[model samples]
Target: MAEEPAAPTGARSPSTRGTRRRGSARHRSYLRPEQPSGSPATSRAARRSARAGRRRRYAMEALAAFAGLLALVAFVGWWSEPARQEPPQPGGLPAVVGRPSLPGPVPTALAVPGLRPRERPPSPSPSAGPPSPAPVAVPTTLTVSQADIPDTVHLTETGRRDWMHWGLGGAGGTVRKRDGTGELRDLGGRGDRSGWDGNQELFRWRDGAPVKSVEATAEGVYVCGTGNGFQLAVAADGQPRTATVYLGVWMARGRLDLRSSDGGPSRTVRLEERHTSRSAQVTIRFQAPEGTRLLLSWTVEETFTPHCGNVGLQAVALR
Candidate 1:
């Protein structure tokens, strides 16, 4: 009766009809996905796609973290280390104090096998100096006489003439004969006797032939000839202030030169045509210094053809 009264005005009875509808709707909504349901294969494909997306997001996050770590390490390294600096060069001003100086690169020593060791340079000797000059042996007094002349003269007789051959003596003197027949001849105008003629001439022997005649003088076992030069070295007994040379000449037309080892000045005497006929004499005077050797030399130049003359050193006196 009460229910009949209540249902009288637009009120439905609480029945299972509305309950089933709401419950089914809620069940359908709960069971249905937001996206439409596809086939089984499509569903599996969608699930695989979701898994792949999740993996990609995780990979990106890991990569970002790794990049941040690398940045942090680089920053720390840059801050902890010192700034690089160039090394100072030599011959320049020194680096400022309290500033760190970079060390220079060390030089490497190279080693080679089978190589010889380097030789050390010779050290200078402290006691080394220029050597002293050698002392020259000077005679206290010396005399040159005809007896001191070496007996090395040669004479050969050939019927009408005689030949005199004399070599350069051991005193290191030279004799050169030119353009003459070097023979002692008898000057008897024409057809004269041979052995020791009072008038004899000297000739130059050249090419095994008698070429020209030379003037000669026979004086004291010595035959001095023209065009025959001689250099004689004589000793001095003492340091003489002056020297006088006596020359024995016949028909002289030559020159006499005097020199000394003491470096004294040289003197020359020339004989002209005035003393050409017979025996003549010449004197050469020169200053002689102490501790000096004397050298006497005679030279004859053939200015005129058949120039007849002979010269010899008779004596040399030093005082």
Candidate 2:
């Protein structure tokens, strides 16, 4: 080829020859790529796999975030609900009222659940009303005997303590049965300092453990109900044209007291054993103005033995 154009010196150099060969190989590799059969498909598949992997990762991250948010929302909702409360039961009764319904008959004690022992209510003032009729003279002076009257004694509001709801513990009692025997010995008050109570509305005594102490307070009367049968009788210095009455009947063991507005000695009401039975009856008699206000009470004393009693009012009628 015309002597190869005199074999250019620069091209004939070893380093230049090597460079040209390398360039040629590089050019051939770029142009034909040795006719690689599966290379393009493999590269395309790899790119697709990487893209799919990235998409899968994004989806998984999104799902994880969604699950976390859902759990957080559920927890928040559960924490925001209100708690439930229970209501009081039906048929429950209050602890205090004006007075019992009947006489001699054991009065009903106010019954309520969940009441605190120290929850004392203030006493109410006397009620204002018209003056009652005066006591009239009878044709003849008949000796009145202790008899079982079907009515119960009703205590006046003023008779109660300055802050006593029912006695001390929002309750009181009367003599159930007064057998001159030991049956009436156990005396206890549900309210009072003793704080003794029971399921029965009436105060009950264990066979040998009836209350042994009898005490009286401005709140009401407390008796052991078993001493030599209490002596319920008319006061010694009784006045004509006047009558006395007792209040409250249903209670544990205790006594009824007669207090004068003039601050005289109190006469203890007594229980009489009925001729028909061993049990006894409670009675109190005194002289008071037709509409005169009276104070009654049942207090717990600091004796070793316990005593219980009731508070109530008596009926006053002209002969």
Instruction: Compare the candidates by TM-score and give the number of the best one.
Output: 1
**lDDT (0-100) at residue 178 of candidate 2?**
19
- TM-scores, all candidates, are 0.27, 0.20
Reference-based lDDT, residue 268, model 1? 64
Clashes per prediction? 13, 54
* Candidate 2: 10-residue stretch with minimal lDDT: 157-166
The per-model lDDT (C-alpha) reads 0.42, 0.36
What TM-score does candidate 1 get on C-alpha atoms?
0.27
Residue-level lDDT tens digits of model 1 in 1-319: 3554444566555776698889999999999867557778789999999999999999999999999899778656644565455456588966443344333377233323444323334544578678999755543332222222212211221211212222122122212223223221111111111112222223222222232322332322113345565555444434333333334345556566656667656656565443442222333333343435566665553334344345443222222
Best by lDDT: 1
Per-residue lDDT, model 1, residue 171, is 20
Error of 1 at 153 (Å): 25
lDDT of 2 by residue, 1-319 (tens): 3555566555577887899999999998899746375688888988999999999999999999999899778655655544333344467844333332223365333323443222234555689898999767322121222444332322222112110112333234332211222111123333432223321122212211123222322232323333311222222223432232322333333344545444544544443222211122333334543333233333222222233233232222221
Give candidate 1 regions above 4 Å deviation: 1-227, 241-244, 248-252, 278-290, 303-309, 313-319
Root-mean-square deviation (CA) per prediction:
19.1, 26.7
